[model samples]
Target: MPWWVEYGRSFFPVILAVFLLRSFLVEPFRIPSGSMIPTLHVGDFILVNKFTYGIRLPVIDKKVIDIGVPQRGDVVVFRYPPEPSTDYIKRVVGVPGDRIGYYDRVLYVNGEPVTERVKAQALREDGQEVLRVPEQLGEHRYQVQWVPQRSSRQGEVVVPPGTYFVLGDNRDNSKDSRYWGFVPDENLVGKAFFIWMSWDSQRFAVDWRRIGSAIP
Candidate 1:
């Protein structure tokens, strides 16, 4: 045994154990965009349940254990397809073999329009062009925003097996499958279920209302 290895033998297991714990358990992430707005806000600290999907070797992203699959309405954090180092948050809109379409700001799943009843739209004076769209997705209800007259990314996509389609609640602002492509099942990190805190220098204050809120 190398001197360094023997010197830390007593603590080697402890160090490796911590690595295994974080690799297969919960991981922390900070929200950097409004893509998941209302559900998760900028600066909000979040915890992702890694084992909910399956167990994958860290860094390599190869699943070694088959635990289960992602369910509809689950908010997830994943690596951006174009940039793996960067992480993104979005709601699972279409699962494997599901047909997903978007037109006129409405979502259609499997050839049927997923119902969304608009509640209200807010025009913020911050010049960011944000309009909130609150709707009930089956039993799960949440608010998303549609930027006025900014509907640019529009199209239809059929999710393929071993891949999932994701969309941001800030539909008009999010760069998701609509722009890039489907997220490989292996790329999924975990489900995001809470908003621990939020802050934006542009907003200039901590959003107390969002604290401790359960992500819908």
Candidate 2:
């Protein structure tokens, strides 16, 4: 009956709808670094499907519904283990109970190499030349890049249950699972599936070609 109650009645529904959609449906994220360079570029505005894995409540990140789990080769966004406040995006290389190895610029799972082609060079957003490879991980096919002459991490680790090993598309330049550790199931934010907009900060230009492109 009061003025404040009337104002709340008009706006409460709209605010609640937005909150529910962002928390349970899809969320937007911006690429701030070149970690996933070839697949995702810096300044790219992307969308993450929150319900791809499962329905987790917002803030505390507790899953109340069973839907799905992360799969190999899927590009996912998760909270950084070292700092849960930070969200990181990477490709899932090793799922639960999988053995992973990286040597000679090749990735191996369960002692078998994941198929990839010869390195093809590409220009980075910063104008540096980096080597790229067309690799297939499960059903997802994508390209990964690395700086020539830079040393990358190489080691073998068994992915623990309820955790996954992830790596950036920019191999040598990225400090990912190779540097820290695996991503826990609960830390996952969502699956990155689309790029709605792209802004190349270096050239100060909008990449119209990348706009509306689906992220593979």
Residues 21-85, candidate 2, lDDT per residue (tens digit)? 99999999999998897899989999999998999888777999878999899999999999999
Model 1 deviation from the true structure expressed as Cα RMSD, one decimal place: 3.3
Residues 1-216, model 1: lDDT tens digits: 898888799898998988887799978788877777667767888778899999998777789999988877788988888888888889998899888888888788888766464655667734676666665555577777777767557678889999999888878778888888999987788988777777766779888877887778
Q: Which pairs of residues clash in candidate 1, taking residues 3 or more apart in a chain or in different chains?
A: none
Q: In every candidate, how many clashes are there?
A: 0, 0
The candidate scoring highest on lDDT is: 2
The C-alpha RMSD of each candidate to the native structure, in angstroms, is: 3.3, 1.7
Worst 10 residues of 1 by lDDT: 113-122
In model 2, the Cα lDDT at residue 95 comes to 97
Q: Each prediction's Cα lDDT score?
A: 0.80, 0.89
Model 1's alpha-carbon lDDT is 0.80
